[model samples]
Target: MTELRIILFLIGVAVLGAIYYFGTRKKVDIEDELDFSEGEEDIVSVRPNDLPRKKSGLTVDEAHQAHEAENVQTQKDKIVTLFLHARDGQQFDWHLIQSAAEQVGLEFGQDNLYYRFKGFGNNKELIFMVANMLKPGIFQPDMRTTGLVLIMTLPGIMPALDMWDTMFPVGERIAEILGGKLTDENHHIFSRQRIASMREEMREFDHKHSIQ
Candidate 1:
């Protein structure tokens, strides 16, 4: 009887030990799996939507105005543009256009367009640029265009007002020579009022830059 009791006790202890071992091993394995899952999450890439965005406290119009002001500050000069167009139902003759440009002291050079320079040779300063109103913006022999575009940068080799003064007459001369009409950028007639307004703007620009 004693022997049987001892055997029973030993069997109970063995069963309890087995249960404890398996339970502890299972718990360790579950913890290791959880740690591995966390490590994978750390290496995963974050989605763009999850990233933070900056909140600018400016309204759309205010932001646009600020951007324009910044551009004006950083840009070397302000651009003034004018157009020369043929009469309705008419196109400019390529040969006449070339002659008119040359007559106005414009040289056909860079970008296959014409340029007016302030001085001679390498010391020359570009006053303004001219381009064909058509696509590719180049003057080619035997090619007709409805118009030409003149672009001048203000506060260039001279004061803004002075540059405008120089460029306007050149446009007028080209118009006269080509039988074309001088127009504003909007293709409206270059009226006296518009000229006055543009001169005033140039004056303001010159004053702002402290240029004589």
Candidate 2:
């Protein structure tokens, strides 16, 4: 019985040793296989041109301008169509539009302004009156009414302005016929700072128009 017990103990020890050796060797073999599959010689070759580098001196403004200008142009293309017509059959004035355009610079009409005139209090019919005269079919801002309309649509485009604050700039529209007084009640969405900045911009805009 003692001899049998010794033989059984020896057999148990040999089995545990075999299990430990095989377990360690199996782990090593798995690691080797992974390394071999991912060998340096098998790595993909990337040319210097294929490696993308961060472009230097790229501004957010430039990127945005590029992205927006990727397709059609003109402010009319950017948003829902709104036509500008002079009341009483007076011709829409080009000088006025040019002056307003000058305020915002050469890029003014490039998909930034989109005007929908609901009119101030007591004047809900204004939009219908203007629309009735619109020539059917889509058109970019006409030579006549471009500048005056640009001013109203220019102020609310900063990235900081929340979508709700994107109301039209009712003040400083710079047209003798219109823009004298719109009630400020509905326009309170703008910060005082924004209004002040817009006014200053219009002043500069007017100055540019005078020179031309």
Candidate 3:
């Protein structure tokens, strides 16, 4: 009888151990299934470089051309960058900085905004120099502006700021200065009319792409 009892106790432990092992495996299987399902649904977000920098739907050779296209005027010879947010935009906030620069009469050359940087931040900023040598606290509208409109679909995914994280905090600080709270929930952050127009423009752009 003692021998039988000991055998039964050992069997019970073996059964319990098997059950625990199966339970742990079942939990792991459920987690694997969840991860697979989530992975199928979520599309990976891409960086600018990761995406093919297409022959931009639009391009401008000079800041003056970009400025005139946007209907903004600038007298000061400062480069106006749209940061990483601008896709088709040539010039934005050109007049804002130009106006401020005019106040100080701190004249620079138009050639400055033309050169491409070989060993600087990733966007290889052209418009950034204006914000670099800033006389801070002068243009106190809470941010930098050039009177030029920034044309981009995703404003939040600004990459120009990330590129210049090493040298100084100019791009990020300037972006923060430019952005502000939207008064109306329906109102767009970038531009009121242009934002509304972009939906139609996107459809046309898509249609044109499909035809090709």
Clashes of each: 0, 1, 9
The C-alpha stretches of model 1 lying farther than 4 A from their native spots are 1-76
- TM-scores, one per candidate: 0.63, 0.23, 0.18
- Lowest lDDT sum, 10 consecutive residues, model 2, at 126-135
lDDT measured at residue 19 in model 1 versus the true structure, 0 to 100: 23
lDDT of 1 by residue, 151-205 (tens): 7655567888888998899999999998889987666787889999989999899
Model 3, stretches more than 4 Å misplaced? 1-82, 86-91, 99-107, 112-168, 180-212
lDDT of predicted model 2: 0.28
Task: Give the better candidate number (1 or 2) by lDDT.
Answer: 1
For candidate 2, write residues 48-96 as lDDT tens digits: 2221112112244643443354232333211211123244335445455
- The candidate, 1 or 3, that scores higher on lDDT is 1
- Model 1, residue pairs in steric clash: none
Error of 2 at 15 (Å): 84
After superposition, the stretches of candidate 2 with alpha carbons farther than 4 Å from their true spots are: 1-85, 104-167, 170-212
Kindly give the stretch of ten consecutive residues in candidate 1 with the minimal lDDT sum: 34-43
User: Over the full model, what C-alpha lDDT does candidate 1 score relative to the true structure?
Assistant: 0.61
